[model samples]
Target: MPSLATRHEGHVLVIEMQRPLLKNALSRALQHELVSAWQELEGNDDLWIAVLHGVGGVFSVGHDVPELARGEGDEADPEPVTGLFPLELSRPVIAAVEGPCYGLGFELALACDLRIAAEGARFGFPDQHLFTSHKVASVLLPHMASLGIGLDLLFTGKTLDARRAEEVRLVNKIVPEGQALAEGVAAARDMAQRFGSAEAFQKQAIWGFPGLPLSTALNLARRM
Candidate 1:
């Protein structure tokens, strides 16, 4: 079976991580599938938005350590820019998170435009314990939450439950366990039907104009 699967509910494309046995670990094969899925979504004009979720109760346990230990795949070949990561998507993508979302999993959610985490969801960056750093989380976490909160998670490798995550603005909404996917799909459909292309453009402005000078950013916004 494929590690990733994509289906459509009206205009919303639902991308599910299917590797439940491994807690939906992001292996190189899965990353390649994700890239292909994003490329398909980008090319399909009928698809308005996307929702990312995982099978089983867990969202993702992060990277496949065993696979890495075996030296099976090239970690840097495909790269994040190839749509293996969330930030590359121009269209809006919502993350429906449940169970543990750590390391690469946490970074995936951080890259999404919106996040709806279940009550039992856990978010953290445990990679620090392994003396590793998360590139996306390091830059995006502070922007999503706060400098202090971001630093705390990175330095301590501690997890925050959904409620705490919501308090820090890391989660846009928190639903009961097993309801995140439904809520996320509903939200995506709402935005797809009501907002149309405006959501995409707004996301572009929010993510793209961040590091630019005030005048340059404003100029770009005006053009958009």
Candidate 2:
């Protein structure tokens, strides 16, 4: 079966991680496919938004440990694999999570502009107890949550369901199980209607300009 699948609907593209047997683990091939697919979407003027998800019961089981353990991942240099970083996307992307979204899976979702999870979905940085982790929660989770909250989850490696994630503002919405992707697509469609062809440029400005001061942002906004 294909490791990943992509379909375009209206102005939105949906990419599904399709390895149910591994619970959709982020294998090297899958990562390569994701990067290529996202790059295609980034280059397309007709695509306003993209929604990412996993098939079957889980969003992902994180990186393929067996592959990494066997030295099979696409590690070309000291930098993290290109597939693991979606920060280069020039357009808005949304993550529709269900079942378990853990470790690098959680980080991938965090990379998106919006995350909409299923009511039955689970989320966590469970790799803190594992030796192979990159310790993203130590740095990124605190920025996303209260310092106390970050410590609670990170130190314990505890998982939370959809409602808890929403309460913590980790996800934008929680819908019925089996409906996360649909809900996410609906949200993306709504955003597409609101932004039209300028959606990518707008996302680039908002996410790309936050590091700049107010005057810098004003100048950037004027250019936009």
Candidate 3:
């Protein structure tokens, strides 16, 4: 079976990680499949939003440990632009996290526009135990929360439960266990119907303005 599967509900595309036995560990093939799915979502005019989740009650445990053990690594240098380092898709994407979201998985969720985490969900960078650096999370987490909190997670390699994740504003919403996917899809549908094209521009501004100087950001906002 494919490592990733995708289906569409009206304008909301649902992308699921299919490697349940591995707790949805992201192998190189799965990463490529995710990128392809995002590319398809971006190219389809009918699809205005997306929900990314994992099957079998797990979002993802992170990169494939076996692959890393074999020295295959996550992916080659200069990773694909689509899913690596948060590509600028015209439409927004939401992450529905159920179980453990660690390492690369945490980075993936952080790349999404919003996150809906289940009660049983946990977030962390366990790979830090191996002294490995997470390229995306290192940069994204601080922006999502305070620098102190982000560094705490990174340096300690500890986890945050669903409530803590929400407290820190890492997740937009929290639902009962097994309801994250449904809630995420419903939220995506609501946004698709209400946001229209303006949401894309708004998202662009949200992502772009953070890195700009105050005067430049204000000028850009004025133009928007």
Candidate 4:
């Protein structure tokens, strides 16, 4: 079966991770497919936003341990793996998370411009407790939460429930279980319609504001 799927609902592209048996693990194939989906979002004028989701009851369990343990998944990717780092796309993407979102799964959601998680969802990085991880979370966690919070999660490899994720701003909003997709899609649709004129500019400006000094950021915004 295909590892990923994409469909459009009006201007919102819905990207689904389809490897339910593996808890939607990030296989190399899936990662490549995701890049294609993002590229489609970037190139298609009719597509204004994207909503990323997982199948089954779970979001993802990060890397497919079994595949890696077997010394597989070594194929070099043409582009940077999508969820492991913040992807640069002209259009905004929202994560609709449910169940466990761990390791790269958490990082993927963090990469999104916004996240809407189901009430029973979980978030964490297990690589600290196991082998070395992709470590992209090191760059993103601090951006989303306090240094202490980021360190605590990174060092302990512990999991956070949706409520705690919300408190730490890991997720933008929490919805009833099974409603994250609806909420995410609705939010994407609203943003697409209301901000389509300058959506790309707004995304670039907001994401760029983080690491820059206030003066530099202001100048950058002026240029944008």
Please report the candidate that would top TM-score against the real structure: 3
Task: Answer with 1 or 4, whichever has the higher lDDT.
Answer: 1
In order, candidate lDDTs are 0.85, 0.79, 0.84, 0.81
**True-vs-predicted CA distance for residue 71, candidate 4, Å:** 3.1
Q: How well is each residue in 1-224 modelled by candidate 4, as lDDT tens digits?
A: 68999999888999999999899988777877888888888888888889999999788888766666665336433223644343577678899999999877777888888899999999988666446554667888888888888998888878899999999988899999999888999998888788764365377668778888889988887887
TM-score of each: 0.91, 0.87, 0.92, 0.91
Candidate No. with top lDDT: 1
Model 1 TM: 0.91
- What's the lDDT for candidate 2? 0.79
Weakest 10 consecutive residues of candidate 4 by summed lDDT: 71-80
Q: Which consecutive 10 residues in model 3 have the weakest lDDT in total? A: 72-81
Per-residue accuracy of model 1 over 1-224 as CA lDDT, tens digit each: 68999998888889999999999988888888988888878888888789999989899988777776675348633233256676766688999998999888888888888999999999997665445457888898888899999999988989999999999999999999999999999999899878776345466667887768999989997998
Lowest-sum lDDT 10-residue window in model 2: 72-81
Give the Cα-based TM-score of candidate 3 against the true structure: 0.92
Candidate structures ordered by TM-score, highest first: 3, 4, 1, 2
